[model samples]
Target chain A: DQQVKQNSPSLSVQEGRISILNCDYTNSMFDYFLWYKKYPAEGPTFLISISSIKDKNEDGRFTVFLNKSAKHLSLHIVPSQPGDSAVYFCAASLSYNTDKLIFGTGTRLQVFP
Target chain B: DVKVTQSSRYLVKRTGEKVFLECVQDMDHENMFWYRQDPGLGLRLIYFSYDVKMKEKGDIPEGYSVSREKKERFSLILESASTNQTSMYLCASSSVTRVSYEQYFGPGTRLTVT
Candidate 1:
């Protein structure tokens, strides 16, 4: 069973606009959520993360909103740049000490000029 | 910066052949993992080791085995390669950092079983 799911397979946005990516999970045990951005051939790099206690976390142009009741989270990028084009993956873990993470299928984001 | 390196970028093998995929991490991390990525399947963990000479099977360990003879290196072994095993393999390592619990990944190895 897929504990975490990224319903959108792909998304498109114009430069200087906003981009939103959504993710859902079936396991309520997951308390930590992370978003990773991946280029074509390189490994995924960490972008931002949020804990279950907070409803929203912001880092520069990236913001992650978590809703425990809905078991859903979203990544929002303001003033999206062309360089932001890449595959975005959402991952979750039961806790920090657990170490192992369950990742979503990934959403390909394309920022156009 | 944490660096995770895989033995090969691309590999091809035939059915019934034995295949070995190696991974090495330079950050002196205590945790290492091996995962397979497919189009719609995302990343599925095959095995993981928390320390030298220790290993644990992940969600999908069928037809595969792993070894962690050293803390810096982990190996994934396919005893009898099958076409179904063709996919992108990734290696990752992580430390016990207080701020982040994220794992660093390698460039990935694309294996094709013919």
Candidate 2:
């Protein structure tokens, strides 16, 4: 069984709009969640993260919201830019030393100029 | 700055050949991971190392083995390459933390077993 899941395979939005990507998990043990962005050949880069203790975490243009009761989390990128076009992955870990992270299938987000 | 370096950006090997993929991280993080990314399966962890000489199998470890000889290096080995093993391999490293788990990845190595 998949502990983490991203149901959407792809998403498209206009530049300067808000782009929301959803992720769901079945394991309640997960306490830390992270979002990663990947370009074609380069590796994934950490975009933003949210801890289970908090409902939300925000960066400059990116925000991650966690709803523990719903077993759901989402990443929102405001004022989406053409440079934001890439694959996004959501991952979850139970705790600190839980060096292992369960990742979703990833969502390809395209920003149209 | 944290940097993870992979041995190769592209590797081509024949079936039944022994294959090795090496990764090095300069961040001195306690955790290092190896994952394979495919079209539909996303990123699947094959192995990870928490410290020197300490390793653990990830979700999918079959047909693969890993070694962490030194603190900054992690290696993934395929005893005998198989066609099915062809995929993009990514290596990542992260500091041990409770609330935040951020991993730094290397430029992936695309491996093809012919």
Each candidate: RMSD to true structure?
A: 1.3, 1.3
TM-score of each: 0.96, 0.96
Candidate 1 Cα lDDT to native: 0.93
lDDT, model 2, position A29: 91
> What is candidate 2's CA lDDT for residue B3?
91
List the DockQ of the predictions in order. Answer: 0.72, 0.82
Q: Model 2 chain B: which ten-residue window has the lowest total lDDT?
A: B94-103
> Could you give candidate 1's per-residue lDDT for residues B2-94 as a string of tens digits?
799999999999999999999999999999999998887888999999999999989999999999999999999999999999999999999
* Chain B TM-score for the candidates in order: 0.97, 0.96
- Candidate 1 chain A has its poorest 10 consecutive residues by lDDT at A93-102
Q: Model 2: which residue pairs collide?
A: none
lDDT of 1 at B47: 94
